[model samples]
Target: MNFILYSDVNDSSISASLGRPEYSYYFVLKAYHPVLESLGRVHVAASVADVDVLYRQLLAAGEDSVFLSFTPPQKTPVDLQCPTICVVAWEFDSIPDEEWDSDPRQDWTQMLARHGRVITLSSHTANAIRRAMGEAFPVLVLPTPLWESFAAIRQQQLPTPVNPGTTLAIKGCIFDSRTLGLSADALIPVPLTPEEEAVLAAELEAARPPALTLKRRFVIARHYLRLWLLDAGRQQIEPVPRVKFLSNWYWEGVRDLLPDAVHDWLERRLRAICAAQPLPVAEPVPLNLPDTSSVVETRVDGVIYVSVFNPRDGRKNWHQLITAFCWAFRETSDATLVLKLTQNDLALYYSELMTLLAQLTPFACRVVVMHGYLDDAQYARLYQAASFYVNASRCEGLCLPLMEFMCSGKPAIAPDHTAMQDYIDDSVAFVVKSSEEPAIWPQDSRLIYRTLRHRPDWGSLKSAYERSYRMATTQPLDYRRMSEAAIERMQHYCGFSEVQMRLSNFFEPLPKVTDVASATDNASC
Candidate 1:
């Protein structure tokens, strides 16, 4: 049967979509397209908006086709006419009972159950879905595919040890200062003058919204009531008695019933609020580097530790990672910790990262912050120059960077929890201990977005860093063995042959069209 790959991310050019959903899906296309073509013609939608048209065309052609949506199940077009499959990556280990009523994606399981079959990236997600949906729900485990094309860019040579020491440059952006409650201004003030204090107080007062007028309160209540009613209908939840009558009217009709003056007033209030918010007037300075070195340079006998992630994403636990690394190597000048931040705006978090670094002063080890742009070749160099790939993430939804590094024969220092559990082990990585901790579900807005996930032990992570550093420095033979193991494990897990077999098996059970010629003729209509 033919396969129709559909994703909204595919709408943009690959280059513009890096560090986005498109980037991940691009790899999926590379891994699946060839194998799919061998079975039958594989067509991709122009965009997610075009999937409905494509689905209709496929049906008219009488072709045996399967629609695979590489986005969240809720985002899938409800009107599409095809046998659809949703590929999802959920990081949580379980769905709590309390979240069923508030989590935004709570309906995701039931929606997929009704609209299409499910494909998850790991068994953890599959189990969670099964528990929430049902034991008999059809959910397949399809690990994210690593593109073989990356093999061409893999480091051609192994890292050579330097005589005195080496600097490991971690390449990436820094988090915005505002994210860490630091001043976004170029200079953070220790104290404020009387005039400055008055200005600050006025600004703070302006930031607060004016007291709600009785008319405004009515308008806001009506707006939310209409939304709640609509949501209840869409998710099939029982409408509360208070809004039961509002649910009977079309949403547009209910909205029309509101006075035009209310909208105008609301708009004015929003604009006023926006105007009160402070804007940054100056660019932030670079943090934590020696005057002698303009860039991170590689040195011999020096172990370079590297990790790449978005500093703003709470799941990454970057603050803890930096703290642990500093504590572990405080007295060692032979090693450096490199953080490659993936966020686009470096100024957003540079000051905060520096602030965190400042708390670890009087240490011998150097911490480098890589910011701004780098071409693909430049990025590959960062990976190739590293002694080991480290991840202290609290959870993961199939870490692509970790996988890519392993594919290039680099040993890893990572936590064996969440998605990493699928492959991480002591044989291939310095596995840090972790335990469940309460957290806010990143996507949820209700109940203060409360949730739970693994929290990697900082002490254990510090020990891992020390162990990996010692191994890279003194135990060359063991390090080589671990590197080889990392390559072998990643090869088996993400190798093309293995992925092809899995894909083939996934489709074998589905019925196929018996007459391709007849189907083509019908499709022309």
Candidate 2:
């Protein structure tokens, strides 16, 4: 059988598509390539249109062909001529069963029904589909085959509870909180004097569109006054200003016509009213660094906890990840948290991340932020440098990084929820606690809460950190046992031979037994 594969992202587009919805599908396709080749000749289609073209060529040569779409069911092409199977990675508890935005594909059940067969990265995702599509739905749970890829790293570097000191080199810039001079006060804006406030309000009034009416102007004034009173109340400022309460019914009707300037003014005024604060009128400054591709290095020692994530992705729950790490090891100078950011655009989360770090300041624990691509050597160095892998995500379809580290024999501090349920256990990880919460589908423009995602417990996560650090510092034998268990878990979960056998069985009755033998020599993993 000839296998044709396609994903929205590929090697050429991955850098630009980082943090895009479903961009990780590209990495999934890459991971499956060798395994697919082991079963039959594999061809990666550059575009969706090329899928059918390649399929026809193979068909004309008397070769059976199958198209593997590494994308969500909604994005997969329904018109393809060859047998198509969608490779989905979903973390939500329920799939969208209703249509929205006049797009019928929003209802995943319809798409999966039409596709006939589907492959998901986790049993959680498969169960979600089976729940909507019925238990008979042909959905296979096959995580990306990654265990074999890290064999060299696992062999070259044994897991150690404490790093002697390792220099991690990256092509992008590094930000250390110790060097950042983080100050929560820097995030606050300076209060405006009464005279300055009057001047600014007059300027805003002058800039208002000339068609503005007295009634609309009063509405804006009332809005700001309400805000001022609320701030005063929160700050416990005595002698609050008394303003007549207008019917919110009246305000709601007029709020739509309020100029954008009014909203902007309200934000500025609120920032300027935190009275008696001597802070500058600026938010935390975004990082200024050398070119992203410039080589930078940093050394990490002691008990190091590393986490990789796209900060812009809301499901990452990075706020808790950082804060918990800081609070857990506040007085421990040797504890370090290294965050390897996966997003290309730093501006998206820099200010907020810095502000969060600033709030947890005066702590001896270190926080290091590495932003850029790591070549193979650097990545392996990062892998071996970690004494433990950390993931405080709310949910995960399949956390490839966590699995990768585990495959390299580094244990984790993570939640055994969603996809993690299949592998994480007390034997291998310090399992954090989580609960379900309402969530909307990623593509749902309606923002209706029709699904459920995990909400990781912050206290549980902080406690896990403390416990893991204790294990790393005081219980070397126990840490080693957990490290070995981590590797064993990945080997069973994502090893090449096991994944290949599942894929082969899922796609039974390929052209001939010899066809598989013909491609055996060409398989890389």
Predicted model with the maximum lDDT = 2
lDDT of each: 0.67, 0.85
Report the error of model 1 at residue 302, Å.
2.1
For model 2, how does the per-residue alpha-carbon lDDT over 365-391 read when each residue is reduced to its tens digit? 999999888888999999999999999
Lowest lDDT sum, 10 consecutive residues, model 1, at 516-525
What does candidate 1's lDDT look like per residue over 115-232, in tens digits? 5457777777888778877887777777755646457645477543222443333334333222333322424456889999999999999999656566755676677677766676
Instruction: Show where candidate 1 strays beyond 4 Å.
Output: 11-35, 95-106, 153-155, 159-301, 448-451, 512-525
User: How much does each candidate deviate from the true structure in C-alpha RMSD?
Assistant: 13.1, 12.4
RMSD of 1: 13.1
Positional deviation of 432 in candidate 2, in angstroms? 0.3
